[model samples]
Target: MYIRSAAAVSPQASFEALFTGAAGYQGEQLSCIEPDYTSYIDPKLIRRMSRIIKMGTAAAVESLKAAGLEQPEAIITGTAYGCLADTDAFLSRLVEFKEELLSPTAFIQSTHNTVAGQIALLLKCHRHNNTFVHKGFSFESALLEARTMMGENEITTALVGGVDEIIPASHALLRRFGLYRANGDSLRLVNEPAKGTMAGEGAAFFVVDTQQSANSLARLDALQTWYKPSTPNRVADGINALLAEQGIEWKDIDLIVAGRNGDTGDDALYDLFKKDIPETSFKQYCGEYPTATAFGLWLASHILHEQRVPGVEGLKPRRILLYNHYQQTHHAAYLLSAC
Candidate 1:
């Protein structure tokens, strides 16, 4: 039900082979430049894994190792674009090689479930293994499922994660569809801007279990995701619902971690609320990736454990509420109370 050990590989120089540290992004670009695969993956295994599979697998391994577990009862993942690099590579081969002598290596690894499958294979976990690919909510969806598993006692240990990779042709396609900007310029949220949100990519994995994990960093108070927001008042109402459910109050919290990615007008929902709760800004570090929210979650977990707010990461947060509004149509919120 709670994230005990969370690890990630993000564009911000967070390279743990499985976990990465806070590295800054310089441009409109956000990417996970992976750690050395040779170090974490077997050479024989390295040749076959697509980047998504590698990212998820490496994170899972490190997270479990950090939690001092051999394997989880279930492995679940969320991905906006699964094995995108491999899919693009296969498509290129399909055209360049005339689909004549195309290798199945890339194509075989190109599915949404490949990452989950590979983790299961490596861990030899034959229990619950599943994947969800739902645009931006992919990772959160996986996390929600793991929460259910924990509550039901169907599984005690669950490895849940989100992984996404950038693909050139897909970026071009997104640009054409107006999901991206024209000049490849960095986009930040304004009260009102001209265009849309920026594109970002990363992988975040968490070791979750029913047992009281000694490595537990944060205790999850609530997790919420919804579509169709009518007003800032509605969001406030949602926050109230969470607070009421958890017997928490607005001023009882120490920090707030917000995903205000500087979307044209999309982040307004959070902007209006921060005025009331008043925590720190997390998006400035991770940028506007869909799962960038994961960093906020991971940071909150770390903050709870350290019993001290991390420098800039905690500059404004004490109760650490992971909050975000995406695509102008989706809003997600998570509340983490210090343990």
Candidate 2:
């Protein structure tokens, strides 16, 4: 399958802004640079949507528009943390009011599927719709499901997205677990090699189809996920296996986009995996959300389409390999090629 079009709304002003290294993070949490939702959604409807919903919907709309699609045959989304603001709201109200009458709006929008469901509702797309919430594998799972659906001739085109939001409450709780860096320079996230990384959230949507067209940005050649590799060599073996399945070798991969979040353990694994291949990190730009690899995919697609490497020091790539892991357990590799 090929990506017909791609759109992203991240902490960066835009996807292009992220690609050019024009965006920066100053604090611990990197929130998305929201677009003008009113431009894509009605003011009335926008009033009720949460931050994640708005980000997801706007990204999906832009992706569909770029592909010249009014509606997709399928809407697949991946969210590690879904609608955190609404979830927190409903729970706080439930507690504060002592289980008395509560508004259903927050509760209704708190589920993991709300982002995908809202996008479908906005588009009136009643086709095959699904959402995956498997932590780090969420986005990869969505992409794999879409690929399988297309391969089975179940759908011609699909809107695939990865959406997540970082709320203050959740951010504070996660920080308690030592998941975010404490008083570290944001620009040096990948180089500092710290115990934690900056927290971030964003949404990225892509219009993918079985056939390539003039609007095609890049080919989704292969996607594979592994869990709990015991050793660094095992991680390398997994990548080798993915490349073998594609009938290619390590040398054929012109660039490797690594998910090096500056965590000492995770970066060590990445170093072991990419020791022989030219590699670059995107976490410095996107931060360390579970679905941040979606932004990595968007970045890789742009690099392949524009034939211009980002400011990262790496070879200009014709075939790109994306390697992402969560907590050093859930590992995924996505192979992309210039179309």
Candidate 3:
């Protein structure tokens, strides 16, 4: 599997949001500020779109356009909270109407698969479709599915994405549970506390194909998700295992794109066990999102194309490592070694 194209809309100036350079977001909680929906989506359909659908579809469409693909063989997406705006809206309506006169629009859009469904509707595609919402590993789940389908005889040009929208209720709830930063403060506020990872929301999508298209920045090297990261060495071992399997080692990698933010600067998940390996961190600019790593993959592609790394906070390395440690122990890592 390989990524032909990748696009994202996040709190920071991702995609066309770039002005001076892609920078970090220091808000209380990381949120994808969203791009101009009108530019990528039709005005007629714009008003009805919930944030999740609008952002998700927009990223997916840009990826397709970038890949020079009109239609994809499959649509796979990952989101911890899919169509949250619609979910919150529907619930609000249910409360107001006592659940009797509630419209089905919000309810239908709230499903985890709504993004995939809406993309299919607009693109007139009825191919294999799937969505994953496995907490922080949601996008990884979607990638897993795409990897399998890409190996199939008839499948090619698959669309994969990850998205999450910030909702007041859920954000508050997460704060209460210590899952998010209170008052949307910079996560570095608790960096020394060393127990909390920042809360973030975003949507990232890509056009993938089984065959190595000339347009592809780099092939899908491999993806790995872990239930528990007990030690720094353990996380490094996990990364090494994936690299070794591909007959590639850490030294051969041009860079390691990591999901590391200042908040978890010391979390063995961000910095590597081995200091010798070069790395690049982007969450400070893109903010923290479950799918933020998707952009890490995009940055990998960008570096491969532009032969330069975007301005990321703190770290000063050339090679990128897209390593993400979601929650305290549960983590996911993607090695975006240059092709």
Compare the candidates by TM-score and give the number of the best one.
2
Candidate 3 local lDDT, 141-239, one digit each (tens) = 888888877666668778999888878887777768655444333434333334444666677788888777777776666778887666667877877
Estimate the lDDT of model 3.
0.71
lDDT of 1: 0.71
Alpha carbon lDDT at 117, candidate 2 = 92
TM-score against truth, every candidate: 0.88, 0.96, 0.87
In candidate 3, position 11 carries an lDDT of 68
Q: Model 1 over residues 141-256: C-alpha lDDT tens digits? A: 88889898878878888888888777777777766756654433332332224455557777778888776666776677678887677776787798889878988787776667
Q: Report clashes for each candidate as comma-separated counts.
A: 16, 0, 17
lDDT of 2 by residue, 206-236 (tens): 9999999997999989888888877767868
The 10-residue segment of model 2 with minimum total lDDT is 14-23
- Residue 167, model 3, lDDT: 80
Clashing pairs in 2: none
Q: What is the C-alpha lDDT of each candidate?
A: 0.71, 0.87, 0.71
Instruction: Give the runs in model 1 whose Cα sits over 4 Å from its true position.
Output: 14-22, 96-99, 177-197, 310-318
